[model samples]
Target: MNNRTGAIESVAGNSNFAVNSALSFGYRWFDPERWGHWSFDLDFFGSYMGVGVSGFGMSDHENLGFLGMRGRVGYRVWHDRLEPFIGMIGGSVLANTASGGVDHGAVWGYWFSPTGGVRYYIPNTRWSISLDGFFRFIGGVNGLSGPGVTINEAPHAGLGGRWLYEPVGIVALGYRF
Candidate 1:
């Protein structure tokens, strides 16, 4: 499950929240006898970020969607039932702005996140639960311009040209095989 939620505070001093859901699949490999409690994982995910409502007080116009993959390294502790992990994610996104139900042109961009999480495995079952958090960085590279908002009457965007930062939290249920 890729359902996530988070808060956004804009330069205009407006704070709002966003929600997104996705489907994901992953593979984990661990060899406790040889590698202690270390593990490696790779996951692929796709999600729809929903309509863009500018936290900066601008009118909502864009619908954003993304598809991404993550790679993680983890260390297990406490009878091998608890694991803490760190990972990185990279993906492509599509943003489209519309007015009056008329479709506008779509712009493509790239996004990345530096993520970490903890997972707890059930004592007697191949099941687990996790809580993950990350800060996502987004930027438009093609045909999408203009600052998202302004602060002190000055334009404020992300790093490296035009960028946006979003913080997210996720709670997930999992199965291990």
Candidate 2:
């Protein structure tokens, strides 16, 4: 009976994890301006994540998902064709979970994340794209779960990193206000 239960649990968990992974994506907008020949940017983005747990005797462990929103303000150190910029980011993650036999289950919680990253912009065009990376510190109450409940687990508070893909790397495309 125990073996059968474990097998059922394993199959259920994998299925949930797959669903979560398929739904992950991030979207953002930004606005940059030049002052004293230095460019400043304000940007915002939303992210969705799904994580699975595997590594213990526990087959009934839960799967996690998060909906996150972030805002950043940055300065361009170099303003040439390949512009390099430094910036600070602040955001919150709305964590949730999916568990318990094909049912979409969730618990609510919030975490604050701070991050920094560099962006490289392609030169000369109101339509340019950039790649940015950042880290976040997560915290809050949405990490715990009860029986038949799915909760989004926060990553250990501290440093984290992400890759940001800007469709139009141009400053005009990402307007702050």
Candidate 3:
């Protein structure tokens, strides 16, 4: 979430967190045992962003959805039960609405995040869990324009700032075949 509001009227202070839900499908290329304890994966995912979760103190409960893809490389350690990885994800916003603060326009843009994490595979099973952290960069196409609106007079560039930054956390459950 970009902290610098560009022109949107409704003001919501900048916070360090965002709420979202996502699911990912991926394929691993090789067995670590045969590849010197290193593995690589490519994944495609979709997520729904839940802004203003409770709207407890805000005026609007806004939200959106997006799809993205990422690639990760991990190195196994501790008997191959734990692996650490680094990756990058990029995507575009696919949907939005015309209600509530700052983003009450047809918002579309691109975003990317650089991430790092660790995965723990359960013994004797293909199940695994991961925890990751990332910082995302989001930018709009010509600063939030919609029908009957011009970039110069668009109702406050959605989300204000031409670009925004968000620090995000992710937890994922995985299954390998």
Candidate 4:
């Protein structure tokens, strides 16, 4: 339940938000029956983005992406009309980057992320809303160009900015069965 992580495209003229487009897919498994308001979860998420690049070899653009899986423990309060939950997620993170086109070669690494989020569930319905965020700590790598920022940053580098450890935010719609 969140926005995809990657470089944000900045396009000229109309279609302003198009520059910020990202493709993301995720799956989550949860226990519907809470054990004393606590639940267990298994989650998987992935994202990809490519944008036009300039001043980098003869490459047309840069591509970056990541895939991750995490286990979570959560606690819910007020299980009736409005349910609020808080959870912590931890897992392995894999990221890869292709800069200055595919010919420049791609660099990748394994990393891990610790995340927490709050979710609101509406009663009598299977739909829910969530806002989650996490920090990406690249394994032993430091410093990356925009494309390298994600996995090295693990899909947390959305813009052309420098960061030691990158942060990501996710606001997405979810369904519970």
lDDT of each: 0.72, 0.40, 0.70, 0.51
Winner on lDDT (2 vs 3): 3
Order of quality (lDDT) = 1, 3, 4, 2
Which portions of model 1 miss their true places by more than 4 Å? Answer: 1-15, 52-61, 98-104, 145-160
Best by TM-score: 1
Q: Please provide TM-scores, in order, for all candidate models, with all chains considered together.
A: 0.73, 0.47, 0.73, 0.55
Tens-place lDDT per residue, model 3, 109-133, is: 7778898999999999999999988
Model 4 residue 49 CA deviation (Å) reads 4.6
Q: Show model 2 residue runs off by greater than 4 Å.
A: 1-34, 51-79, 99-105, 148-177
Cα lDDT tens digits for candidate 1, 1-177: 111224443332222776776667989989988888999999997776665444434445656787899899999999999999999987988776643233456767778899999999999999999998888777754554333422112223644344666787888899986
> Model 4, range 33-127, lDDT digits (tens) per residue?
64556656666666554455444243344444556666666676775333334444433333333443443345555455777787778677889
Q: Count backbone overlaps in model 4.
A: 7
- State model 2's lDDT: 0.40
Report how far off residue 129 is in candidate 4 (Å).
1.0
